[model samples]
Target: MTRNATSFPFDIVLFDLDGTLVDSNRDLAPAVNHALSLEDRPPVPEAEVRNLIGGGAFAMLERALQATGGPVAQTRFAELGAELLAHYRAHIADNTVPFEGVTAALDRLAQLGCKLAVCTNKAEEPARDLLAKLDLAGRFDAIYGGDTLGPGNAKPDPAMLYAAIADCGGGRAAMVGDSTYDVRAARNANIPAITFRYGYHDVPVEELGGDAMIDHWNELLPTLEGVLTS
Candidate 1:
């Protein structure tokens, strides 16, 4: 792989938004609790909500409902899910913010001319809205949500990752995310992956199967550089 001012081994960097870039638990936890309250169920703890994320809104709600013994029917979940999405959108950035050093790290990557994109389990519109709210939307060349490629092409399937690479001009790429969905998708795509330690991982970060694990945004560039050689 050649390394130069305008050339690098990887031309694109795909990121998973929720856990990898932003900590959305503050807003997500309350929204799910509110949705649960609508069904007269007890509120699930914030920590539990954090664990349920990375799969998308519906999956999060499903797990929350299951935890509270609420109805899990197709219709019932849809009805409550609508409420949850609405609540989330209404207060998307109430407490959501990019993790420490995220903006600076993104700036560094952009300066290096690496095309950046987001592949998240969140819905397209909400993802855009949230990123815009946080002033991070303009930084990405593309953003694909769980529903962006239909219901079956989300993370852990590699469809979205493939789409992201193609959409970003189809070059050498790497994935940066926080959970199994991210790592598994990277594996399916046959791309190197780096897991961030501060994100919302259901299990252990070491077990997520990333090519590398980074504890802070400052380490991302070096990790990506290493991936290029190895």
Candidate 2:
């Protein structure tokens, strides 16, 4: 594709679902706690759950388990993970919401001819379900989740990112996310990444090594433009 300096800088903008696009921990924490409760483990505080995000349900649950006690057996852990997913699916959007200005930013991006897509470590079914409930699914050309390409193909691997771009019909692309996995995937895919400071990150957002970082959705477009064009 030919570059058009005056137009939007990227043909597609890939986003991470949990932290980057929506504040999901409000709902996620409870689901995690639900699983922990099944194991007679103490509940993880919602505030602290934010740090446990990024690696997906299993990882988050593992972190929660580790914090509360210790790791469970593989069979038991899988069962708890299943329980967590069931609870999460039932109440996925109870308290989850797009961060302020997300709608407006997405609108502006679409108007600028950017094809939006999601490349998340979340499983595809629930990710789609969550976005559909939020009325945000229609805005994206594609939504490639962790399980989309089968097991062992989630972010930080770059497989899903590449798949999302191809499914979006491939073009100049950039990633917008809030975790090391996201940034690492973007790097592996040779795309610039813009990190959101307000999203869940285990490390300091600055240490994630994104091409740029923004504290709000209002800063997204301009920051992305700068990253992609300069």
Candidate 3:
């Protein structure tokens, strides 16, 4: 298919915020532990919390509740979310770090004139704060989180992905994320999705059926190379 006049031959890139860009659980892990501790529920492992992150704060909490074999009470979940949010809000940047080579990849995309933005399942305030804290806030033309877009929607729905593409101002764009949610979101939007090997999918990478997969952030440049060159 011919590229659209305004469509990117490789112009716009929409990135997932969690496992794709930064490991956010330094805030997430301790916050969950604190809340569970308050209820006498055993603390969730940091690794599990890390795996649980891409879906959003409440989703992670729900997973934790299941892990603990609880009644899945909303009141308890709300209590936990409040505590976790309080702590996480205070230390948003403490343990956050960009994946190796992320800056270099983004810099290359920038130099190539690829418009960039972040579309994340994380809520708006935290997604924006994390971007600013990581110093990656300026790279994207737009940012969208679950709360920022309005109620009752998120990834796998394509609304957030389309919003980012529109904000970047007319270009073919792809979704980069760690889970099936990303793939489904991209398909729903009629855009392509790329899965990262390093992120938090509960299943193995090959099962994802994305346009491409990468184990390292730097591989992106050459992956794009293969596409634009071919």
Candidate 4:
């Protein structure tokens, strides 16, 4: 793939997992449906499930419940959460695969001496499991999940992004993601953010307020450099 020869500008490139690095909607959507099925609720369509993602599995399931009908039964929320997680863990990568050009882009970034890491709302173990399955686990200097820093530490909170930067030895950092959660996290952390246009964004990618936007992984380096300089 073509690439920019400009010098790298950031110390770290932190990526959001689902919809950003990998397309796991096939598996994720099913997991949501499975949880709903257990509660005898009608299965939400996969297209709708994509929008419900990004806030983590609990949020996805909660949204599914709400989108299908009404408020989730508080008594079964935890049980359904556990069930969803278990189902997802068992079929983590059934249809999941890295987005086009992801590996090549990662290699290019690594060659530029940019530390790579992941900060995602997916729970840590499943995130690790999926990456390992795709052989991309070794690519990240650090991998942080929603549960990594305990409650409320996930993206949109900035804790995970901060942790990813710190884990990668700290320097200039920028975030890449496909949703508001990622951009909000980067903004809250006072860092630049780049949004991927092809991911599962619930709204217009422009509204996410990224420092820059990339429609393909091959554009990542140039976009990151542009974000840094601007």
Query: All candidates' lDDT scores?
Result: 0.88, 0.90, 0.79, 0.87
Please identify which of the two predictions, 1 or 3, would achieve the higher TM-score against the true structure.
1
Candidate 4 vs. true structure, TM-score: 0.93
What pairs collide in candidate 3? 8-172
Q: Write the per-residue lDDT of candidate 4 for residues 1-230, one digit (tens) a residue.
A: 11223366777889999999999998999998999998899998887788888788888888888888876668799999999989999999999999999999998888888889999998898899999999999999999999999998988999888888888888888899999999899999999988988788857766887888888988888777675697
The local distance difference test score of model 4 is: 0.87
TM-score of 2: 0.96
lDDT for position 31 in model 4: 90
Clashing pairs counted in every model:
0, 0, 1, 0
Ranking by lDDT: 2, 1, 4, 3
What are the models' TM-scores? 0.93, 0.96, 0.91, 0.93
Point out the worst 10-residue segment of candidate 2 by lDDT. 1-10
Clashing residue pairs for model 1: none
Q: Write the per-residue lDDT of candidate 3 for residues 1-230, one digit (tens) a residue.
A: 32343333576788888888887776788987887788788988888787666568778777777787664567867878888788888888999898899999998787777888888888988889989988999888899997777876688778988888877776667677888878888889988777789887745667877788989997887776575336
Off by over 4 Å in 2: 2-6
Candidate 1 residue-pair clash tally: 0
lDDT of 1 by residue, 107-175 (tens): 988888788999998999999999999999999999999999896898899999999888887878899
* 2 against 3, candidate with superior lDDT: 2
Window of ten residues with lowest summed lDDT in model 4:
1-10
* Higher-TM-score candidate of 2 and 3: 2
